[model samples]
Target chain A: MMLANKQVVLKNYVEGYPKESDFELRSSMISSHIPQGSKGLFVKNLYLACDPYMRHKMSHHISNDVPLLASFNPSSVIIGLGVAKVIKSADADFEEGDYIWGMTAWEVYTLILNTNGLFMIKYTDVPLSYYAGILGMPGLAAYIGFNNLCSAKEGDVFYVSYAAGGVGQLVGQFAEMKGCHLVGSASTDEKVHLLKSQLGFDDAFNYKQGNDLARALKRHFLKSIDVYFENVGGNMLDEVLLHMNLCGRIAVSGMISQYNLKKLDGIHNLFCHISKRLRMKGFSEFDFWHKVPEYLEFPIQLIREKKLLFVEHIAEGLAKCCINFCWYLLWAKCWKEDFSSFN
Target chain B: MMLANKQVVLKNYVEGYPKESDFELRSSMISSHIPQGSKGLFVKNLYLACDPYMRHKMSHHISNDVPLLASFNPSSVIIGLGVAKVIKSADADFEEGDYIWGMTAWEVYTLILNTNGLFMIKYTDVPLSYYAGILGMPGLAAYIGFNNLCSAKEGDVFYVSYAAGGVGQLVGQFAEMKGCHLVGSASTDEKVHLLKSQLGFDDAFNYKQGNDLARALKRHFLKSIDVYFENVGGNMLDEVLLHMNLCGRIAVSGMISQYNLKKLDGIHNLFCHISKRLRMKGFSEFDFWHKVPEYLEFPIQLIREKKLLFVEHIAEGLAKCCINFCWYLLWAKCWKEDFSSFN
Candidate 1:
């Protein structure tokens, strides 16, 4: 069967901040059935996550050499992590109606050439859209960065930048659950309030208020920060280095602030890493895909017990993809494009 | 008995590059005996090590909050790692005629008030000066950084900056002995030659020659660097980040280049840490002092086997301390003050 596949395509390589004009909505015809004898899954996109890392792929000169982060070709479909339902499958592991989440294109339907990166969504009890956020890449990123990398302990002073972002929110909760004195920085006072009130963070601050981020961090952390979940890189990272306690650990999840700029901001305080004996590591959720089964248990348990809270703004339809993504880039609340209507 | 103690004292808090004018040689009288009933060792200085970290202590505004890195007070004798002969001791662990190495003042005679940091030198077979370079703090630093931190294995591509210095030389040898493909960078062509010829590095380059360090690194590292032992921070670190392989490790032993600068060179490539899944750790030998015994065994064994080579330029008398220290800061060959004549 032939289907009209609506895709959000890259207009051209993005420079500086991405505007809606950088992306174009294009509809193309595609076969709904998987090719005979080929190991491909013809899937219907349900929810597509708008993430900061996606901005890197949009850039003409992507800095990273990682194959997983290959830059997007001009006028091609933007691919991202999303929840989809398998319409037809040539692979033995999946069949029609199987809900799965992994790397998928921003379109109504996708013929997945590689099935290895995709995973069958087991627990449908949680919101299917959550598979794109807290239950998917963002959730796993928080798990790998906070739980695996930070080595966080009770009473440790934990700080997270962009704390109201998808992964940062979860990290703050995880730190709080571990009995840490959690402090988070958000771009707006509203998000900061939500982080402290709704997410149970010990303290939260609007980072945009202060010109001196180091002094801001100092005021929040009376003792000093032991663990820092770095999301907003550049100047934020430089300032955090100054307030880190001895032997502090910083898990660099994403540098959202630097992804758009032609020149990444210089981090001058790396000397602190030596003097403070700090360990700063950069990682992606892609690296920990093998641990999906191992990681799913805790967040799933928390969601079921009503212990974990997720805040997300859902944009309806593929047409809203570009504008919502632009909003997300401006540090809007965590957003996901709802394509469930196409199903 | 009273003894005339000749000393090298800091004249003032240093700015920019340290000079002989920043230090003064003074002679003072001190009792040759340990303070009565106190746990002290009256040591006759044998050899004093001049290290890059000493430059930080000389700065008027020291950046690190580490207690072990407290800035040197103006008009006070500079304290550093040195080998000495105990002439009188009230401490039970040490006695007259015992040779030891630890934190000692730069003087002909040092009455060590705190004996806790001192360690009794066991092997007298090697030159006593080896205790200041090869078998002392630099040796332990290389051990902790390379063996303990890098998780280096055979065939791994390893690179070390300041490869002919006290610590970098040992790290290069360690990488070579591990059967890794080792490359190193030094400031001078002479030091680069010493690294390849005397130090057994697979490839060595003079980082000072080419303005394009990234190109220089790429030329040396065909397969990219898996382990980077960082000594020269600043732009070298920024360049090396671009050439790192997947899952690379960087052990930040010291940032010699930034020690004297009022504003550290901005590191613009830290984002590579995420793309490469790199682990960059900053550490000091002070943190692992408890493991000194364990660390000493490996380097001492290597020295005994005649497999390890150490290059040191020794200056006789405490009067030469300031000049030698200034030379050492200029990336001159590792220098030690020989105070044995005072015994």
Candidate 2:
């Protein structure tokens, strides 16, 4: 039997920033049955992640010229993370109707190869779309960044930047689960409420309205902040250093503020990291990918048991894909609460 | 019985930065016999340490307004870290002619009290001045920073900033002794040669002459920087972040570059920490003070066994004390490799 597929392809190489014209929507045909000796699996893509990390992948020069991140090839599909159902499979582990999720494309169907740690979503009681964000890469990032890298102890106070975003939201909740006092800074009032009320953070503030970030942190943290999960940098990171406790741990999860800027800002309070005996480590989820199987189980159980709550600002269809993607990206960058009125 | 004595004291509080006018030398009287019920001893100071950490004591503004370390009060004898020989004592553990090293005054003769963890210099066959540095606080800082904080493994590539300074010089050698490759960045060609030739580092360079720090690091360490002992911050730190290995560990010992500056330079490459899963930790020797008893014996033994080497830049005479102290404070702020040229 033959199956139909819709594909999204990159039209050309992006230079400084990505525009809507860089992507093109097209159609293709696929065979539904598995072919012998083929490791590739045909997946029906379900939920696609609109992540800030994707922003780094959108540009070629910054990604290619700098040896820091993987470069995206021109004229190829803009690859990203997605939750997909395995509709046709030739891989030994996956089969027809087997619900799995990993790094799929921004298309309706993708032929996935090299399935090293692409986990099958066995736990179906919760939202499968979570495989794209909270229960997937972002969740692993949060766990490893907070629990492992920082060595978060009970009663440790945490200040998370972008606390309402994909990884930030989960990190806040994970901090709560560890019996830590958490204060998050989001871009919107709704995110502030979501962090404090829905997510059970000790306190939260809108970084958009706060004139002085150091004062904002000091206001909520009273004594000192034990751990700082830095997702957004620029002045926010500089301010957090002043209030960090002696021997404080800062897990560098992301720095979205400086990602798009042509010239990056330098932090003034970095010297405080030495004086206070603070630890600031940068980490990514790629290293902790081995822990995904057991790691994914925790978030899935939390969602099913009603212990962990998550909010997804999802876009509906293919026509609104680029606009929805931009909306989430911008919201994630600035204060989401400020833009809630438009939503 | 009255005895002749000598002491050093601060004339007044240093305002902006320390100058020669801040201290005064005085001659007083002391008893040869230990005081009754004092469990105290009389000692002659031999060598003292002029450390950058003492600069924090010069002003009331440093240490978050706490008087943890303040320069000697006006009209009172000045105190510092010194190696002293016991002349007379009543304490059961200490006796006459016993050589000991600890936090002491900048004077010829002194009465010792509150001897907490003060031990006899068991291995003193080498220069007694070694006890003030490689066998004391600086040595312990190097050991703990490399061993405990960094979890430094064999074959790991190491980098130390302020590599000619007391602690950094030892850490570079220690890395070599541990079968790891070492590179050090110092202020002068002399220090770079000293690091490579004397201290047993694989390679070394003058960070002062390096135009692009990131390029310099890439040129030296083509592989990866496994551990970074950060004694100098600002641009050096930014470059190190860009070239750090996956799961790299950074020991935050000091940041001399931005010490006096009210506003510090920015680090643009911090986002790599997250992507690379790097570990950056800040520490002080004071936090691990409890382990001094266990720590003291190792470095003392290392120096005695000829496994460890150290150098000290001492200025003679009490008259030159203020000028000498300023030299150390300035050295801490900038790259000073020509200690011999100061005379």
Candidate 3:
């Protein structure tokens, strides 16, 4: 049997910021059944994560050395993590009618040739879309970063930049639930509003409205910040350094501000990293993979208890040019949307 | 009972790079005996460490919140750490003819009002000047930085900037003794030569001669660098960030390059800290005071075994104007002379 796969393909190598015109929607035919000896599960992508890391893939300038962030070839199907139901499986680990999440192409159906990356869905109590965000990479990143790196404690003053985004919002809620006073910053008023009112952040502000981030930080935190969950980097990291308390920890999750630039902005005042005995660690979710079983238990339970609230902007099948709009927002270093769009 | 204490005083708060005219040599009379019920040690100054941190105090712009670093009034005697012999004592912890090391003024005869800060010289068999450099603050800094923060391992590729300086030299030797391959960078050819030839660094380079530090690092460390002992920050730190391997660590002991700047040089590559899961900690010796006894044993034995070598540029009764020379070199952010000079 034949399957017609509608795919999003890179049209050319992107430069600086990716434009909508850089990608093309194409249709291709593939075998409906999993190929023999491939030991694969055929997946139909349901909810694709609109991530900033994907922007790095649209460009040819990326060095090949970076793990898990390899550039996509021109005219090739864009590979990403998404929620999908297994339609067919040559591997015994996955069966038909099973819901799963793993590396899938931005297409209607994907033949997952390598079963190594496939994660079998164990629980079906929550919305399957949650697997693409709060229960998958972004959730794991937030969990590992907050628990392992930040070492957040009750009554600790916590601040996270880009706090309205996928991982940032989760980290802020986690800190707040731990009895930490949380301050967050976002690119727009709505996101800031959602952060303070909806997501339970103690305070939220529009970073775009501030002239001096240092003064802004000083205004809110008259004393010092204990843990800084650094999602976006550049001037924010520099200013946060000045306000960090003794033995403060900075967990660098992403530098969205610096990623698209031909040259990253310079950060001064890192000397505080020494004088105050600061710990600034750059980490990925892979660092805490061994704790996955132990890590997933709490957040899943919290979601069930109605104590944890997550904010996300849902969209079905992103408009072709909107991908450029997304990349433009990434270049702008923050989103203007409610939270995020999924396709 | 009257004694004339010769002193070097800062003429006024210096702005930018200091000049030779910024200091004045003066004399003042003080009682030779300890004051009644003072519980102090009357002592003569022996050695003073010329440290970059002292430069932060010479300017009025310095914030008062910094631990243990305070500014002296114009025309007042400069205060610094020194090795001394007690001439008289009212404290039970000390007696006449006993030697000690503590924070003291930049003068020949001084009355140490706070015996609390003084450490009685138990290990006098080593040169007294060693207390000012290796066995004192700088040595303690290197020990804590290498063992506590770095967690160095055999077969690790280690790099230290300003590798012939007091703390840098010790860190490199400690790494080398740990069976790590060591690379060092210095501002001058002679210091570079001293690093590899005298201090046993596997490779050394003169940073002044190179414009491309990333290339320079790649040349020396063909593979990834495991540990970086950052003595001098700024552009060098940016470059080193590019060469760090996965799970690498950076021990930021000092940022001499930025200490005297009205504005510090911007570091652009700190994002690598995240990409590589790097741990960059800025620490001081005060954090490890409880472990002082446990930490002191191994290094003293290393010195006793002749397995460790230390570099010190000792000068006695420095001209008042030469303190400005030290300040000038501090603004330049590297050293032309060796360890220090004192009056």
* RMSD vs true structure, all candidates: 3.7, 3.6, 2.9
| Model 1 ranges off by over 4 Å | A62-64, A332-343, B62-64, B332-343
DockQ of each: 0.82, 0.58, 0.81
Candidate 3 lDDT tens digits, A1-343: 7888788877887777666777788877977877677888887888887776777666664556666666778878788888899888888878998998878888888888897756766767977888888888889899889888998899999999988878999999999989999999987776778888888999988877767776778788976999999988889998889888889999999888876677888999898887788999988885565565666677888888878866666566734424644544563453554345421
| lDDT of each candidate versus the true structure | 0.87, 0.76, 0.80
Better of 2 and 3 by TM-score: 3
How high is the lDDT of residue B233 in model 2? 84
lDDT of 1 by residue, B18-41 (tens): 888999999899897766778998
DockQ winner: 1
Cα lDDT of model 1 by residue, A138-195, tens digit: 9999999987789999999999998978999999999999999999998767777788
TM-score (chain A only) for the predictions, listed in order: 0.94, 0.90, 0.92
Model 3 C-alpha lDDT per residue in residues B32-115, reported as the tens digit of each score: 877787999899888877766677678784565566555667777778778999998899989999999868878778888898
| Lowest-sum lDDT 10-residue window in model 3 chain A | A334-343
lDDT accuracy of residue B69 in candidate 3: 50
Candidate 1 clashing pairs, residues 3+ apart or interchain: none
Q: Which candidate, 2 or 3, would have the higher DockQ against the true structure? A: 3
TM per model? 0.95, 0.89, 0.94
Order by lDDT, highest first: 1, 3, 2
For candidate 3, what is the DockQ-based docking class?
Answer: high
Give Cα distance to truth, residue B169, candidate 2, Å: 1.8
- How do these models rank on TM-score, best leading? 1, 3, 2
- Give, for candidate 2 chain B, the lowest lDDT window spanning 10 residues: B62-71
TM-score of 2: 0.89
